[model samples]
Target: MDPVRRTPVVVTSALLTLLLTVLIVNLIQPVDAARAERTTAAGASSTSTVSVRRFPKAHHPSKSASSSSATKNQTKQQKPDPAATSAHPVDWLKPSQQVDYPDPAAHPGLSLEVSLQDQRVYVRDGSELLYTMYASTGMDDSTPRGSFRIQNERGDHFYNPREGMGARYYTSFLNHGVFLFHSVPTDSKGGYIKEEADMLGIRPGSHGCIRLTVPDARWIMQSVPTGTPVLVK
Candidate 1:
C-alpha cells in the first residue's frame, strides 16, 4: 500500500517476468533445434530409401539368355581344326565297299575256295560268293585239295623255317599255322622280293604253301575267323 512496498513489488514482478521469458525462450530454442535435426534426419532417411528403391538389383539369366549361352558353348566345342581334318581324313569308303558282301542268312560257316587252275581264291559266306582274288598255290600241283579248317593264324613278319625267308600276314588253313597263306616272301630284312611279286598269281611258286598279296593276306587274317572252311581244287 505504501510507495516503497509498491516499488519493490513492481521490481520483483518485472524480474519474474524477465526470468519466465528467458526460460520459455531456452525451452523453445531446444525444441526448435530438435525439430530441425529430426526433419534433417527424416529427409536423409527418405532420400536413402528412394535411392535404394530406384536402383536396380542383380538378376539371374532368363531362359532365352541361358539357351544362347549353351548354344555358344556347343559351337565352341564342336568346331574342329580345318587343317587337321584335311590332313588326316578318316577312311569312310572301306565300310561302304565291305557292304557289297551279302548277309550270311544266319549261317555259321564262312568258306574259302582255292582254284589251282585259275590261280584264284573265292571267299564265300555260306552259299554266297562274297569276293575273289588271285593267289599262288604250291609248285607242281602240290596244293592240298578237298576240305580243311583254319586252325591258326599270325600277323607279323616271320621267317620261313626252310628257306630262312621272311613273310607278312601269315594265315594257316592247314598244317597248324605252318603251311600258310602269306604275303610274297621278303628278304631276311623285310625287303620285298620283286621276283616273287612278279610271279604272284601268274604261276605256282610257293614251296608248299599258298601265297597272296599283302593286302589280301591281311584281309584274310582280319576277316576270316578260325574254323573257317577251306577247299582247294
Candidate 2:
C-alpha cells in the first residue's frame, strides 16, 4: 500500500519542476532580446555621430579675399587713359598772362629757338628747355631761316606807311630793321588790331617779321641782350 502512494506524489513533484523550468526560460529569453535591441540602437547612434564629423558644411569666401578684389577694381579705375589725354590739347589762343624772366647772368648758355611748323619759341639753356612762347612768323617764308645775332637796333614803337600797318617793342634780328620780333599789328593810333592779334601763334600773317604777344615782345625788347644767337627753323 505505501509504494503506490509514493509513486503518485513523485509524479506530481516532477510536473511542478517542469513548469518552473519553462517559466524561467521564457523570462530569460525576453530580457536577452531587450538587451540586444538596446546595444544595436547605441551602435547606430555612434555611427551617425561619426558620419556628421567626417563632412563639414560648404565653404564661404573670407573677408580678406573680398577686400583684395575690391582693391584691384579701384586701381584699374584710377589708371589714366592716354588716348583721352591725347585727344584734347591745350588752347594756346588764350593769353598766358604769366612770364618767368630768365637771368642771363645765371644762365650764360641761354639761347632762343624758333619753330616755324609749330609756331612756338623755346628758350633753351643748352639742351634744357627753360620756357616756351607763342609766336607768328612771316607768311610765304618771308622770315629767313638761319642763325642771327641780335643787333643793337630796338625801338618802343614804329609804323610803316607803305604797308599801312605797324608794331611796338621791336627788336631787329636780321637786316638791322628788316626782320624784327615785334608785338601784334597796331593801327596808326597805337590800338592793337583784334583780327591780327587773334592770328598770333595760329598762322603766318606778318609781312616779314616774327610777331609775338605784347608782353612777350616787351620782354624780348627789354630783357634780351645784344649779340644773343637766335636760330630760326
Candidate 3:
C-alpha cells in the first residue's frame, strides 16, 4: 500500500467574511447601548427642568402702591361735611335787651341811637327797634349828646393823631368830622389793640368817638349809609 497522503485544510473567503461581520456586530451593540443610555438620561433631565418651569409665582402689590390705595380709601370715607365749609349767619338777638324790629321796608327807615348813660347802642327801623349792642363812648362826658346825621362815610380805618392810635370804620357825624362811630383803638398799621378790646362796653374809654366791636363797625360801614339819622343821648 502506498503511503497515505494527509489532506491540508484551507479557510475560504466567505467563511472569513462571515466571521469578521459577527465580531463587528458584537462591538457595535455595546456602543449603541451606551448611546441609548445617555439619550435617556438627557431626556429625563430636560423633562424635569420643563416641569419645574411650567408654573410661575403669583404677583403682589408693592408696599408704596398698597399704602397709596389705603390713603385714597380713607379720604373717601372721611370726607368733610359741606355745611361745615359754609359759615352760619350770626345770631344778633342773643342778648336780653334786644327788641325785634318791624319789616325792613318801613318808612323813615333805619336809624341809630347812642345812650351814653347805658353804654349801649341801638339800631331802629322806623319806630321799631332792630338790634342793641354794648358800646364804649367818650370818657369824661366828651361824647356830645345831640341829634346828628352822618355827614361822610370814610375808609374802613383811619389814623388818630391825638390818641396816637388807629381806628376802623369811621362814620363821621355832621356836627364835627372829628367825632365818629368806629372800632376800638388799633395800631397805625390796622392791627387789633387787645387792650382796647378788654375795655369795650365796660365803661367810657374813648377820646370822643363811639368805639364798637370790630364786626359791628364793619357791619355799620356795609349797611348804614351817609345822611342817616343818629341820636346820641
Candidate 4:
C-alpha cells in the first residue's frame, strides 16, 4: 500500500508572494541574456553550463517594479509580527461570558429595589415593577428584608447549582456572596410557578439576595446603575 502524501498548507498571502517572486525572476531574464551576449562578444571563455543557465536575465517590467513597493507593505501588515500574535491569542475568539454592570439608578434617586414576591424577583424603581423574573433563595438561609447599597458588581461567574456553590452576583444586602441572583434551570417558564415556592422549595436556592435568570441578570446589569440603593425583602 502507498503511504498518503500529505499536502503542504500554504497561506494565501504566501502563495501570492511565491507567484510574485517567480514573475520577477522571469521578467529580469532578458537583461542577463543581453549581458551574456556582450560578454561573449568581448571574447570571454565559457564558464560552467550551470552558471550560464543561471543568469539569462530579460527586460524587467515597469508595472511589476511599481507594484513591488505596495506588495511589500501589504505583506508586512498581513503578517502578524510575532509580538502582536503572542500578546492576544483569544482576541478573535467567540465571546462566551457576558459582562455584568450593576446600577442603583434603575429607579433613580429613590434607589433600586429587589423584591421576592411569590417565587420571583420584582425589580422596581418605587411602586412600578421594572422587570419580573424567577429566582431561588437559601432554604434555611432566608433572604433578608432590608435596604442596602450595591457594594460592587462582577462580570464573571462560576456557579453550579449542584454543589450549593459556584459563581453568583452578590449584593451588599446579604451576609456573603450566595445571595447573588444569576441563572438557574427553571422547572417551567410560565406554568404558574411563583417565586417563594420555587425559590426555596426545591433544588439549590439562595442565601438571601434576589435570584434571577441569566437573561434577567444581564438585563439588571444594564438597567441598574452603580452606587444606587438596593432594597431587598
Candidate 5:
C-alpha cells in the first residue's frame, strides 16, 4: 500500500478529549446560572423590603388596565438571563425622603424645634425621632435660642409677627408661638425666605419654624401635628 495516512491514535484521543470538555462545561452552565440568580433575588428582596416599609402604598393604580396588562406581558414574555442580571444596570432608586412631619395643622400642633447647634429636633416625649426637620431658628433676630414652649398657639403665615421677633423656642407646636417651627417657612420651593447659609442642608436661617430644609419640613409636617410637645433646650 501507499504510505498510509491513517489517523494517529494520539491525535484522535486529543480531539475526543476536547469534545468531552466542551460538553461538560455546557452541561454545568445552567446550574451556575441558577445559583447566581438565587443570590441576586435574595439581595433584591432585602432592599425592596426596607424601601417599601418607609413609604405609603401606591394608591390609584393606572386608570388604564391595559397598562398593567402590558406590564404583565413584558414580565412574562422574557425573563432576564441569570448570568447577566448582575451586570444589568439599575440607575434609579426610590428617594429616601422622610415622613413624621407636622402635617395636621388644622387638627392640632406640636412643639417643633430645629437645632442649629446639633442639627436636631427635641420633642417632649420620645426617644427616637417622632418628628424631625432641618431648621434655622432666628438666625439674625434674637429669636431666643434657649428653651421655651407654646406660649400661645395658632396657625398663620410664615412671616406673621409670630409672638414677636425675639421669641424663644419652647414646648409647643405653634408656627411662631414662644418657639417657631413652620413647614411653610422652611419651604425652599415657595420662596419661603432662603437662609443666608451657603449650603442647602437645613436652609440655615429662620425667623423661626426652626426653618427646616424642604425635605425636613416635609418630614415634620408628616409627623408632628399641632399640640405636639416640643423642647428646644
Candidate 6:
C-alpha cells in the first residue's frame, strides 16, 4: 500500500474511536445521576421515619387521676359543720326562753310528745303541732318511755333534800309527785343552777323528770289539766 493511503486510514480510525468513547461517557453519566437521585430519596425517607418514631405527642392526665381529684373535691364539699348540731342562746337568757309558746286553752285536745333523741317537747292538738318547747328529760334513760297522764298534784316550789336540787312550778305526770314537769334545777336558796340549765334542749341532764324553762313550767302548772295525755320517748 502507498504511505499516504495508510496515514488517511489510521486518522479516520482514530476519529471514529474518539466519537464512540464520547457517546458511551454521556450515557453512563445520566445513569449514574439517576442512581444517585434514587439513593438520596431513600435516605430522606428513612430519616423521616426515624424522626417520627423518636418523638411523641404531648402528655395528658389519665382518667383515674382526674377521677381521684374530683373525688377529693367532693369529699371536702360534703363535710359537715360542727356548730350546726347544737343550739345557741340569745343574750343572757337560756335557749328555752328564746322560744315562743302557744296558748294552751285555745287549742282543743292538747297533748304532749317528748323526744329523747332531740331533747324537745312538742305540744300537739291531734296530728297538728301547736308549739315546740326545749326540754331536758333525764340522764341514762331515766325518764320513762311510755304513755302517761298528768296527776292533780302541783306546786310553786319544792326541794328534795336528798338530791340537793329543787325546781319551781312542779306538775306531776308520773308516780304522783315522783316524776314532774318543772323549771330547770335550783339550789336550796331558790337560785337557778347555771350548769344544768345551760344544757336544756342540747342534752339530757335531769334526774328522771321533764325539765322546762321557768315560764313553760308555770304555764303547764296553771293551764294543762289533769289526765292530759303525755307520750315520752
Identify the leading candidate in terms of lDDT.
6
The 10-residue segment of model 5 with minimum total lDDT is 87-96
Model 6, C-alpha of 173: deviation from truth (Å): 1.0
Q: What TM-score does candidate 5 get on C-alpha atoms?
A: 0.35
lDDT of 3 by residue, 1-233 (tens): 33343222234666778899999999999999999999999999999888777644222355667898999999987899787775332222233243443333453688889999877788887677788766889999999989898776566878877677988777787555688888777887778777775566667888778988776776666667777899999
Model 6 spans > 4 angstroms off: 1-58, 62-71, 82-99
Q: Which digits, one per residue and each the tens of the lDDT, describe model 2 over residues 1-233?
A: 68978998999999999999999999999999999999999899989888877645322245666788899999998888786664222233333346566777778887888889878778788998877878889899987898998888999999998888899899999999998988888998888888887777778888879888887788789888898889999
Alpha-carbon RMSD, each predicted model: 14.6, 7.7, 14.6, 30.9, 27.2, 5.4
For each candidate, the alpha-carbon lDDT, in order, equals 0.75, 0.82, 0.74, 0.51, 0.47, 0.85
- Per-candidate TM equals 0.53, 0.60, 0.53, 0.39, 0.35, 0.68
lDDT (10s digit) by residue, model 4, range 1-233: 33443333346668889999999998889888988898896655445554666555432465676699889999999998897654211111111124333244443654555545545455555676554445555555476667666555544355445653443233333443444555442333222123433333123355545555555655555445555666665
In model 2, the runs with Cα more than 4 Å from the true position are: 1-99
TM-score-better candidate, 3 vs 4 = 3
Q: Pick the winner on TM-score between candidates 1 and 2.
A: 2
Candidate 4 Cα RMSD after full superposition onto the native fold (Å): 30.9
Q: Rank the candidates by lDDT, best first.
A: 6, 2, 1, 3, 4, 5
Q: Which is better, 4 or 6, measured by lDDT?
A: 6
> How far in Å is the alpha carbon of 184 misplaced in model 3?
1.2
lDDT of 5 by residue, 1-233 (tens): 33454556668999999999999999899989998999899899989987897555353354456688998889976887677554221111111134443334433434544466654554433344344433445555535555444434434343344432321122235444545544423232334332332222333444444544444444444444444555654
Q: Please identify model 5 stretches exceeding 4 Å from their true place.
A: 1-96, 99-114, 122-124, 156-178, 184-190, 193-204, 214-227
Residue 162, candidate 5: Cα error in Å is 13
lDDT per residue, candidate 1, 91-203, as tens digits? 21122134444333444666889999877788787777777766778898788788988776667668865686777878888878767878777888888677776666667
Q: What is the TM-score (0 to 1) of candidate 1? A: 0.53
How many residue pairs in model 3 have overlapping backbones? 0
Residue-pair clashes per prediction, in order, are 0, 0, 0, 25, 33, 0
- Minimal lDDT window, size 10, model 3: 87-96
